[model samples]
Target: MNLQPDARRALGAGLVVIALVAFSNSSAHISDVGQQAAVAAVSSTDTLTQLNQSLISANKDKGVLKEGELLEKAVHRKALMEILAKENPAHFLRYVLNASQISSLPKSVTATVEKRISTEGVIDTYIIDDFEHPEKSHYEYYFKRGANVKSLYLVGDLLVRSNTQALITGYEGDTYVVADNTKGNVTIKANKDIDGGSNEALGVQNTAVILVDFDDSGPRPFTKEQAKNIFFNAQFNKFMKEQSYNKVSFKGDVYGWYRLSGPSMSNGQHVIPVFGNDNSQLNRIILENNIPIGNYGRVIIAINSDFTSSSQVGMTMQYIGGREYFFSSSWISLAGFDILAPFPFTWTDLDFLLAHELGHALGLMHANSWECG
Candidate 1:
C-alpha cells in the first residue's frame, strides 16, 4: 500500500505524511484548517480518480506490499470516499445506488437478503443457503429456530454495479452479482458461511494455534514462545476481555513449524500452496498426526508465507470435521521484529493477524461505516 504521488496530491500536500507522523508521535491535534482543506480537496472528481488509480497500482504491486500496508491503503480509500460523499452528495450519487433506488428494491426479493456496500460504493447482496436442507431457500426459518440447526450456509454477496437504473444479475467468480434491472433466478456458486452452531462463539474459547511452513521454506523467523505471546500477551488478552466484557477470552496451545509438502518457489517467486479457499491439506496433516483438533473450539493456522494477492490474507470457515478454524498467512521478515516497526506499518503483527482472523472465526465481519451524507 505504497501511496502513489497522485494520491498524496489528491489528499492535499503532505496531509498523509503529517497524519502518519502525528499518529506515530501519539499527537491527537490536527488543525481545523487542515481538516477543512482535506474535505475540500476530496470533494472533487480528480481526487477520486487519483485515489482509485492509487488503489489499482497498489493491487498490481501487492506481492511487494505487506498486509498492514494494504490495509492502510484500504482505510485511506474508504476515508476519501466518506469525505467525498459527505461534501459532494450530488456528485457521489452519480456513481452509487441512491436512497430511492435502494428503497425501490422488491421487498419479496430483499426479504431474506442482506445488503452491504463496498469501499468502492458498490452494493453487494447475500442470500442464505441451508446445507442441511437444500430444499429451504429463505433464511427466516433458521433465524427463528435459534442455534438449534446443524448446518447453515451464507453465500457471498451478489455485487451489483450500475451507471444507470437497470439491474442485472450474474456470477462474479464464486459469488453472484447483479448487473441489470431484469428479474431472474440467482444460482449460488460459492458457500461463504458454514455454521456448525451459532452459540459456539460464546463463553470461554479454547484454540489450537499451529504454525506451518512449506517444505522448501526457511526456518520460521519467530520462535514458538514468540508465537504464543501473540495470543496470550497482556495487550491482546486485555483488549479481548474489554471487548467481550469478560464473557469471551481465549486459552490456546501453540504447536508447529510443521512442514507441509509444497514447492516453496514457483517461477522464480515464492508461493504458498493453498487448496482453494481453505488449506484442507494443512488440516488433514494435523488430523493425521493426532493433534486432537476436536477438543478445541477454534483452530488458528499461521503460515510462514507472504501473500502475493490482495484478495485475502486471512480467512475463516467451518471445516476439518466441521470444526471452526481460520487460516492466517503473512510474511514477517526479520526486520519486522520491532514491536512498533513502521516499515510494515500497523496491524501486521502476529497478534493483530491472529486476532483479526479469530474475529471472523467468532462470527464477526469487517466493519463498514461509509454511507451517503
Candidate 2:
C-alpha cells in the first residue's frame, strides 16, 4: 500500500510497540497446546492461502495488519517460516532459525558483532519479508554504535576476498569506516539505534554554522548571507518547530568561507576528513578563530566542495564534548554527472536535508518503506 513520508515516520516511531506485540503474541501461541494442534492440521497450501487472505483484508481496510495479530495464528507463522525457508534458504537457516549461529560465526565476524553489542548496548535486528518476492527479504541490524548517528549495511557470512571490496559494494550511509580486518570476507556494518540520546529534545539548541573551503578551492558556491538564511531562516526553523510540537528549535550564527590549509583535491578528487577527524579539524578551526564553541549546543559545517559521491552528502555527530555537529558537503554530482551547483540550491531541498540530519542528531533513525507495512 502507498504511504507518504510523514505516515511512514509515524510508523517508524511505533516499531518497538509492534515488535513487542508480535513477540508476545508469538510466544503465547507457541505455548498453547490447542493452538499447536490447530496449526498442525492446516496443510502448507491452505496456510499460504489464509496468509494471502489476511493480507488482502488488510489492504481492503487500507491499513497494515498488526504483525502480532497476523502472526498470532500459528498456521500463519508456519507458513511464513516455510516461505522464508523455500525462498531465501541461506538467510533463513543462518539468521532466522539458528539463533546460536551468531556465536559460531567466523572469529572475525563474531568479534565484530560482539564489539558492536558491547559499545551500542544491544543490537536490534529486523527481518523484512517481501510478500511478492520472499527471496528478496532481508535483515536490518542497528547497533546504537555512534555518539552521533551513522548508517551502513552489514553483510554477514559472505564469502568474499576483502572487507574493503565488501564495504565498497554494500555500504549505504553518509559516514562509514572499515572497523575490522578482512579475515574471510565478513563485513560488519553498524549504526546508532533510533533511540540513542539523552537531553536531545527539550530546549532551544544553540548551534554554530561554519562554511569551509580549501586552499586550492574555487569561488564559494553561495554567499555568507545565503548560507545564513538557509540555517536561520523561517523555512528550516519553522519546520523543526512544528515537527517537535514546539518543544524544540534551533538558534545559531553563521561563520566561515575559512580556507583550510590543504589542497582541495585528493588523488584527483575533492576530499575532506571524515568520521572523528572532520569534527576534530572543525573544532580546531573554531578554537583558532576564537569562536567560543562553548556558547553553542550544536554545530553545522558546510563545505564549498564536491563530495567524492552523492551518497556522501551529510552526516552528524550527536555529541562532541556535550554538543552536536553535522557536516554537509554542499557541492555534489548526481548520478555520475559532472559536479553541479551546490546541493540544496532550492529552499525545499535544504529544508529536507537539514530536517533529516538534525533528526539524527536528535536521536531519530532512518525509516525504511518496509517498516510501514
Candidate 3:
C-alpha cells in the first residue's frame, strides 16, 4: 500500500486519518491498518462514493448528512446514524435503551474507530470491509454486540483540531470493560497513601493504580532537564504514594513504573506513564486486524499534560477508552481546580487525574450522563 505522501498527510490531517490502503479487493471483508503498501492496493473504485450517496439520501439527519461520504466510506452505516442522531443531533437514544454503557469497544471495531477517532475525533461508522485485502481492509470499524462483551460510550459537546485535522471536539461513545473477576478477587495496588473516599478511592476494592518512578526514559513533551526535579520530588513521591494507597487501600492492583513508547506516541499521542502493562503495546500493530489490548477488564490509562498554557496547572485526561481516548476534544476537559492549583505543568496530578478519568474508564458516566439518561 504505497500511500501517497498526500494520502499519509491526508490521513494524518483528515478528521479521520483513514488509511485508504491497498488490498486484493475480493468480496469485500475487513482489513488491517498496517501492511506493506506495495503488496496491498487500495480501491480507487467509486464504490465508497456510491455507498456514501446512498446513505445520505436514505438518512437526511444533519449530523449524518453533514459528515458526508467520507464517513460512509470509512465506517458502518448503522453506527454512523446512531452517532449522528444521538451524539450529533443531540437526541438521546440510549435513554430509550436502558442499558449501562462500557468504556472500551471490541478490538476489531475499536481499531477502525481509533483510526477515525485519531483524525476526526468522533466516530459514527464501523470499518467492516476492506477492499484493500481479501481478508482485511486498511482497517476495520464496526459495531457488534454479545452477552459477554462490555460496552462503553462517551458523549461530550466540544470540538478539537489537531495536526490540521477537524475533530468533533468532544467525546460521546461506548467501550467494553471485561470485569477482572477472573482472579476471583482482583488486587489493586497503588504507590501512595489512600484517601478512601470518592469513587476512585472506593473503586480500590476491585482495581489498582501503580505509582511510577522513572528517570524519564519514555515519551514526553518536556525535556529531560526540565522534568528531572519533579521525577523524584517529595510531592511527586507523595503523589505516587497516595496513588498506591488509592490502589491498595481500595484493593486495586498497581505495577511500578513501566515503559511506553511506540508509533502512536511518536505520532503525537500523549499517553501517561503507569506501572504495569495493559498490553497496550498491541496497539502498535495498527493494520494487523488483531488487538492485544482492550480485553475484558483491563483498560489502558495514560497521564497527559495541560501544556496548553504556561499558567495552566492541571491534568488532562486521554480516555483512549474509545478506539482513541476522546471522540472529540470537547468530550473531556481539565477542571478549573487543576489549573488554579499549585502544581507544575509536569505530572503533578498524574495519579489524581488518572483517578478521575479511571472512573469514566470503569463504566461510570459523569453525573451529567444521568441527566442525559
lDDT for each candidate structure: 0.40, 0.41, 0.26
Q: Give the Cα error of residue 350 in candidate 2, in Å.
A: 2.3
Give a tens-digit lDDT track for model 2, residues 107-183.
Answer: 33222221221132212232332223323333333323445433323333221111111222211122321121223
Worst 10 residues of 1 by lDDT: 139-148
Ranked by lDDT from best down, the candidates are 2, 1, 3
Ten-residue segment with the worst summed lDDT in candidate 2?
A: 157-166
Residues 41-158, candidate 3: write the lDDT tens digits: 2232133235445443434343434344434443563354333332212222211111111112223323333222211311122112212233432111111121111122222211
RMSD of 2: 19.2
The TM-score-based order of candidates, best leading, equals 2, 1, 3
TM-score of 3: 0.27
